[model samples]
Target chain A: MALFLVNVLDGFVTGLLLFMLCSGLTLIFSMMGVLNFAHASFYMLGAYFAYQISLVTGFWAGLLIAPLIVGVIGALIERYGLRRVHKYGHVPELIFTFGLALLIEETVQFFWGKSQLPFSEPAALDFAAFAIAGNAFPAYKVFMIAVAMGIFLTLLYILTKTRIGMTIQAALSYPETVQNLGHNVPLVFMCVFGVGTAMAGLAGVIAGPVLGVFPGMALQLGSIVFVTIVIGGLGSLWGALVASLIIGWLQTFATAYDITAEQVLTAIGFTKPELIWDHPLQDLWTLTLPQLGPILPYLLMIIVLVLRPQGLMGNRES
Target chain B: MNKFNLMMATALAAGLAAGAAVAQEKVRIAFIDPLSGPFATTGTQGLAIYRHSVKELVNEPGALLDGQAEFEMVPFDNKISAKESLIQLQVAMDQGIRIIAQGASSGVANALTEAVAKHNRRNPDDPVIFLNHSAVDPALTNDKCQFWHFRFDANADIKMDALTDDIAANPDIKKVYVIGQDYSFGKAVAAAAQRFLKEKRPDIEIVGNELHPIGKVKDFTPYARKIVGSGADAVITGNWGGDMVGLGKAVMGAGFDKPIYTYYGATSGITAAFGEEGDGIVKLVGAGQVNPAPTPEAQEFIEAFYVSFPDLDFGQPQMANVAPMLAAAINEVGNATDIKAIAYALEGMEYDSIVTGKTVMRESDHQAIQTVTVQGQTPEAAFEYDKSGRGMVAETVVELASNDAPTTCEMKRP
Candidate 1:
């Protein structure tokens, strides 16, 4: 039971972190109808920016300032780069973002070099928040959970209870109508893209200390971010959240267990092979849940895609 | 004016001839490893180490075979892929680079070994020799061993032999959790750990064994939790690069205060990431000790290496021996162009390693047999790694007089 509780807490932390990256990506997709391939790159930039800032102003100041810098950069990219590419259609927009992602990764490597930076959590939050059955959960993870929940709530409030939020939503559905009503639709798109990237940057800031701050970090989480939104349903915020949580739990539980194919096969009335090591299916026979942990998310994504093409909460068919 | 013009043309021709002769005296080594990808950090560090080692030990004046030949390292980015490595191998061969040096991934190493062997078989006159510095898959020197391949680093089996000896001596370690990346090298480490531990400490139980995908895991909290929950006295893993750092951080973060034994828990940002948390709990099993500075010469080499590449740790101490050993073989053979003669000279060669003392290249398998040390992270380490005050200090040293395991290699000597 204690182990289960710890797994739940760990999974929750992982899920919330994923949601932080997915929320922004889902928002940008909804508004622009273009999946921002560089969304994770923005997250990486956030971490690198914060690491650099933290060197001078400390982690707290970096936490506040880094996301803003990333937001402005994202806004500019959307205005100067994506806006120009938007006319050539979705494929071009995607290619542009893909190129941007590559460029961002290279730029990061050029500056930071190719090594894991010693971006540790603050000393204040270094202690264990709580211990369950000898397993101590650090205060930093709790902080991450808090920050993610705070962003989700704030984003929910602004989108549902505010005028700008309504305008942005209206622009997404009917840009011509919104533009005719005297609102700058392009400006709205730019803001959404900026805000979305900023959120990803925020995730980077928090996740950097835990997940590590390195050049490959963006690539590490890049595909997973896409998978989360896709599993949750494209352009659906709620879907992203749901999918993120599901993946989090799925991976965590899978890793926590030690169930092997041998055990399953034995239970299913299959006898063990005489020369197991020499057997062709030895790899399959020895396969364990923990070994399969990393691929569990992709497996779930495939299952979701096969069963529900539109995603759990997404409106779009894609 | 006619006499001056004639003199100028003669001088230019003489200079061109001298340049060609100098170029002929240069020995080129193609360094094939990941230079652009997730594993680039490790590969880049490796390249830096090789470049620095060659500059200090082979290329510098009064260095090994200093006047005989100038050694140059030509880097080729393999992107850590086997196909790309083979392609790089072909490019290097085309460029007249007879010496191929690589070590990052065992899979790539296997491919290069096969390709080089095939190339040597087909083109015996222009045979290439592979100098492996760090890839530790035992199969590379065992069933898959090639005459052209010489491994400078201790293979997985030997390292595990040294590691299990340390574990056997520790009475407190009754149970161990063995984990590694899901690959050939990782599997070898796990299997070796299991085999060696069972042989050394019969009473000790392997509580858990698992393999996570290499470079794919971002968060290891769940894995750490499982390890802690397993009630293991110690943890053993063969993970390297970011995986090493991540696993170290996660295990330590999860409050598993027990020691986590690893094949590569130091250097390349791992030591820095572990920082104060790893203090005494993170133990690494490998050749070459940096903390206490194994020898005075090694200490000097370490200082010089830092001067050249201040950002990189002298991670691969075996790299210090590679160029010098190769130079010794070349000098014994009397020329760099005679690949076969150099290969024969390198076999059963004895070289005094500055870090690990006297080391031998086994005649049968070409695996380096040297002093393997199991070091622990300590703040008192003389040479701090990755700018982290804490560094690896030698806790246990195993001086092997011969290969730990009998060779399965059947060398086809030409």
Candidate 2:
């Protein structure tokens, strides 16, 4: 029973992290309609920036300042780099972001080297949060959960209850109509992109210590953010939330329970199994979520695309 | 009639000279790794070793590869992709590189093996010989073993076998928990440990078996919980780099309060991340550190490496040193870079190495029979080892295993 609760909590925490990253991606995709493949790169950059800032001004300063810096950079990229590429159509835009992601990863390697950097836990949150059924959970995890939840709530408030939020929603649905009303649609796009990237950066900062800041962090997490967005429905924040929760929980539960596809097949009374004598494929049965974590979000995205094109709570029918 | 005969003899002599010149030319050796990706550090290290060895062995004053002839270490950055490795290998082959020293990743190694095997079947005389120094997959040297591929490092079985006796003898170890990265190396180590424990000490309860992906794992809290709850006396793990360090820190912070036996052993990579957390952690290691009392050859290698790269610390220097040793072996055996000749020379060849002691590259599997070192970390002293009652000193802990033990290859030596 305790193991089940722990798994649930783990899923919740993981889902919250996914939401933090996917929410920004969804907002940007809604407004721009150009899937930023480099979205996770921004998150990685945020973590690196936070790590640097934390080194000088401490973790608190990093948490506050790094996101703002990331936002500014995101805005700049939209205005200068992305705007030029937008002319080449959606395919070009996607390709540009992919190239940008590759460049960012290389740049990270140049700066940080290929080795995993030492990102220690903050002194204050170094100890255990509390013991549950003789198992101690680290206080840092509790802090991560708090921060993720806080970000989610704040993002929700901004998107729903603010003047900028209304403009963002309008621009996502009908850019021409919003532009006809004399509102600067491009400006909204720039801001949304910046804000979305900033959120990713914030996630990076918070996750840097735990994940161990490296060049590959973005590449590993970037596709998952896309999965989260797809599962949640492209532009719908609520859809993203539902999808993120589902993905996070599904992955955690799947891995924790050790329920494999083969096992499922076997459970459904498939007697006389054809032992394929395949080594590597046979090795796949032993795989779990953490093992499959890098690819899980993509799998979910494909599933969503095929089953429910509109996503969990997606606004658009397509 | 005399003038015609003289002219014909001169033309024949010219043709013979051309053939000799072609035979004397050095064959190219390609080295590929993730020079641009997140795993570029491993690639860079591999590149350095290959480059250094090629330079020392092929381009030196008394060179080996082509008898004072020049050969290049054609390095390409695969960026940690199986597809990219294939592309890079083709590029190397296109550029006339017929020999390769493979990088760290098993995926890359497997890709290269298939590509090379296909190439060799078509042109057997001009074949690509892969000298795998880093990839520790047992299958590479076992069931899926290739004739052209030769592994240099101690495979998973050898390393596991080296430590099993010591672990089995320990009375304090009642229950063992196995945790590894959910990859080839991890699964192999976990499976090997389980098999060995089952066969040797069936009474020793394996309480928990936990695995997380190599780089995908962020928080190790729940996994730690599972381990602590397993009522384990000791933990046997093969987590390397970030995972190893992060888990160590998590284990310490969570207060697991048990002896952890790490598989990567006393590698500098692990220590660089989890400095004090590595304290009291027992690890199976290969190269002895320079700070502790090392062999005379090891001291010489360190000094030479320091002169070449003043910024390099002692721990990483062994990687650099391994290159020169490999070079020296090549020089002693073959005076040509012909893969066949070099391959023949390397078979059943024994060399006194700076890092590994009495290294013997076997004729059968081409697996090197190198001395193994087991060391335990000590707290209070930064990066200091406790070799007292631990039985992990150079004289005490280092064990030399025969090549016949792990290798399945039946050789017909030239």
Considering every candidate listed, which one attains the maximal lDDT?
A: 1
| Each candidate: chain B TM-score | 0.95, 0.80
| Model 2, residue pairs in steric clash | A47-A204, A232-A239, B65-B336, B65-B337
Candidate with best DockQ: 1
Q: Model 1 Cα displacement at A74 (Å)?
A: 1.0
lDDT at B244, model 2: 75
What alpha-carbon RMSD in Å does predicted model 1 have with respect to the real structure? 2.3
lDDT of 1 by residue, B129-218 (tens): 999998888989889988999999989899989999989999999999999988888889999999989898999999988889888888
Where does candidate 2 chain B have its weakest 10-residue lDDT segment?
B382-391
Would you estimate the TM-scores of all the predictions?
0.95, 0.81
True contacts kept of 1: 0.82
Give lDDT per model, in order. 0.90, 0.70
| lDDT (10s digit) by residue, model 2, range B145-218 | 76777777777777666656557777888999899987788989899888878877778999877677776765
